[model samples]
Target: MKLAVLATGNIANKVTQTLVQIKELECYAVASRELSKAQQFKERFGFKKAYGSYEEMVCDPEVELVYITSPHSHHFEHMKLCIEHGKNVICEKAFTVNAAQAREIKSLAQEHKVFVTEAIWTRYMPSRSIINKVLSDGLIGDVKAITANLCYNVCHRNRVSNPTLAGGALLDVGVYCINFALMHLGSDIREIHSTWQKIDTGVDGMNTISIQYNDGRLANLTSAITAKSDRQGIVYGTKGYMVITNINNPSLIRVFDYDDKLIKSVEVPPQISGYEYEFIESVKAIGEGRIESWSMPLTDSIEVMTIMDQIRAQWGLRYPME
Candidate 1:
């Protein structure tokens, strides 16, 4: 599979490092608005070709897959461009600023017969099934509530504070918490209550979200760009509770008995930066002529975006693009 990355940012760098290790994917091309940066990225990551602009890269007939790592605000635009070119796309989390954009992309993808899915890597990782198995096997019987938090001290970065970029904790770290809840708790949400603290740029610096499921289950989530957190996802069940270390990238899942004694622990399988799974899945889906990845289906992506949209609506946090 030939792969092209659509950005030359920090995430692009990290993902490219992992891309080099995937034998199934060719480091085909990389694109940036600036030709020099693209050239640098191409040489650094050993991409076969470099494009001065995204349009140029997507225009390449050999580019089988495009991994979009742009900012949240630009995702809809970039995805539209790629879909129009009939390119399979795996976009970063917070698939778009809102569900409307996500829906439009979904429609365009179907119309173009192109594969499109969110690169919320957690969904594709082995740990997700590990956690699911624990719950399914009744190790944590009758799941009742979940508490997940993902926070980082990144407010100083322009991408975290710029309203024009759709910058905020909710779209970034908070999306993980939301996905963490939905992946485990299911998305039959009865009600959603959320509050946020805004940064100087009028974007959410931190936010807390509570979701009530129709099954009488609850999910409490928190995300912030101004602080660091333990990043744990805890599931409370009738028989026992499970502790997931790092909801962002779960490393270990510990199951505890009613007495708070650790009964079992499962460590996630090793990986090459935890991103290869999404790419591998994307490639497989595209090869199978599928329009979505099973790990993070298009409908799931839209639902996650819808939930985020509702939360932002609650906070009255409208971005410039919106």
Candidate 2:
């Protein structure tokens, strides 16, 4: 699989480092608004080519897959550009600024017969399926509720404070907590109640969201950009509960019995920054002539974005681009 990256940002750098570790994948090209940055990124990552303009990079016939690591506000535009050029895409999370944009991109990808997927890395991790199997096997008995927290002191970052960039703790980190709950608890969100504290820029700085599923399961999730959190996710059940150390990239999973005794512990396999799984899945999907990854389908992406739209509406938050 020949892969090209659309941005030379921090996330793209980390992803490039992981891409080099995969023997089957090649870092073919990288692009940025500035040629110097793209050249630096290319030299550092050993990419075959670099482009100052994204349009030029997407037009390369050899670049089969393009990873859009740009800001959330630019995802829809960048993704549509790649799809229009007959290139598959793996876009970073907060798939777009809103659910409406996500639907448009999905429709475009289907019409062009191009593979496009959200790079919500957790959905493609092997630990996710293992945890699902544990729950299905009744190790934790009947599930009742789930609680997840993902917070970081990243308010100083421009992307987290600028409304034009669709900056917010909800779209950046809260998406992980929501994905954690939805991946394990199911996505039949019946009721949603949320409250948030907004920064002066009108983006959410801290938020508390409660989601009730159709099956009576509830998820309590919290995210913040002003403070640090444990980033833990717990699934409570009739018998006991399971603890996931990190919701973003789960490294350890511990299961406890009714007496709170540790009954099982699973260590995730060694990873190359945990980003390779999603890239590998995308390659496989495209190889099979699929327009979307089964692990993180377009429907799931739209569902998550819809939930975020509802939360933002309740908080009276709207980005400038919207």
In order of listing, the candidates' clash counts read 0, 0
| Residue pair clashes in candidate 2 | none
Tens-digit lDDT track for model 2 on 1-322? 9999998998988788889998868999999999999999999988999999998999899999999999999999999999999999999998999999999999999999999999999999989877987798898899999999999999989987788989899999999999998897778889999999988778889999999999999999999999999999999999999999999999999999999999999999988889999999999999999999989999999999999999999988988888
What value does the lDDT take at residue 180 in candidate 1? 92
Off by over 4 Å in 1: none
Candidate 1 residue lDDT tens string, 101-156:
98899999999999999999999999988988998899878999999999999999
Residue 296 of model 1 has an lDDT of: 89
Ten contiguous residues with the weakest lDDT in model 1: 267-276
